[model samples]
Target: MQNPASANANVTVTVTATATVSDFAELPATASHGPLRIEYRWVNERAGDAPIAVFLHEGLGSIAMWRDWPQTLCERLGMRGLVYSRPGYGLSTPRPHAQKWPADFMTAQACDILPALLDALSIDRDERGRMWVIGHSDGGSIALLYAALHPEALAGAVAIAPHVFVEDISVESIAQTKQLYETTDLRSKLSRYHADVDSAFYGWNDIWLDPAFRQWSIAGEIASIRQPLLAVQGHDDNYGTMAQIDTIAARVPHAQLVKLDACGHSPHRDAPEALNEAIAAFVLKISAS
Candidate 1:
């Protein structure tokens, strides 16, 4: 467990085991965007028969920011795992200074970039029996959006602290983060995980704080997600309330919810063992069915 005191500290935690595979994927340019280079790492590469677990990082997260959780979870399930950085995070292509992200940024990632990355990596949906997505925070929203958009392409999804609709709490927390970035050493700390720290931070921060974003909601759209879904949230999550996952359950009748006490926004970091157990059980049950 990460000590709360050192949660934002600049300390390196070593991974005893190495990743099975690590490489870059050069994605073709799209009509709305230019070419992108994504950085990814894989674990348990030989688990060919098992469903692949794709780990999507948070708004400010990167491949390296996931630490060893992806590896540990894949090892536990005897499954393969893929962890990658989004366009503006980690070693992937950084966003241009003048570029402003659209309000539908997360939707675009789900509908456009994710599929392209899957194709680039040659992870055929038919061959792999549909991939599983494990996403956190902003990534969790992306996962839900993806499942909604491509129900046939996913076996299941584990979304931790996903936002279907923007909340005042989320805006407040993001505002606080922005203050920390400008007044504290937060920017420098985050720089270690991102190539262009400002791009990663400001792009996400600015969009969320936009007055137009207040009305943004994926709730109606996500009702279409037919894949088995597990929505997780910490009782103490500052960015969102329990309504985040509760709304998912209300919309997707079959969706399961896990509320962890004494946990924060990051269940995988704050309550890893419990999170792992829930995910393992959820995935195994779905696979058996």
Candidate 2:
């Protein structure tokens, strides 16, 4: 298929269900990758005028990796959905081999790439104001950033296993993952979703482990968010701890929180029933207000 990102800015193909179709948007040069192609997929688009839920993937996740979760959530919420692979993952453009991500990469995604994408897709001001960002891990951090930086653009934000600050545990786990990637089938498994698995893997891994990243923390900034927010984490999550959500609640007192038992890093997969319910109730409560 030809890259739709190559088309004119005014051109937009209404993305519908994946039913064997895919879509792409061209982000601007000032954005992360600058003039890059971002592969995306949609769900429940027939919901028509329903609030949009944009799913931002985990560090190593992609449109394919999200599988049917976004669809399932949209169905349950009776809302339209938008899920996309970031600049260096899935069928999207890959990062240059020699390029290393900056310590504040997630910030760039929130403040730059995401807004550019919404415009490229022609999401108007009204739609943006009613949109909700649902993200996980690094993506979750991006959601928090977006909500904080541009709260008026979002109806709400959901951060699952997000990192408000750097955790030693996260660095240690990622280092071990690097070893597993080299010695085991980790790369092979991720390759099933990404066009260039190396781009997906290293782009995420390199930054989190960068020495300067130790001082990285968005906890102070997230307090600026005025939109309803939901912070969730798994008690057994290895990548982060309950403090992640705890900090969110501490900063944004109105933020709702859900900590799951018998769950891990991926709560949507580990406890979909509980997660879906929490999110549903949150939307209802906020809408009623």
What tens-digit string does per-residue lDDT give for candidate 1 at 1-289?
Answer: 0000101112233222222234677787887679887777777878877778998889999887888899899999888898888988877789897887898999999988888888887777584356898899999999999999997888889999898899899999999999999999999888877778898998889899999999999999999999999999999999999999999999999999999999999999999999999999998898889
Cand. 2 TM to true fold: 0.92
Local distance difference test, per candidate?
0.85, 0.85
lDDT of prediction 1: 0.85
In every candidate, how many clashes are there? 0, 0
lDDT, candidate 2, equals: 0.85
Q: Which ten residues in a row have the lowest lDDT in candidate 1?
A: 1-10
> Residue 184: error of model 2 in Å?
0.6
lDDT of 2 at 166: 86
Show the colliding residue pairs in model 2: none
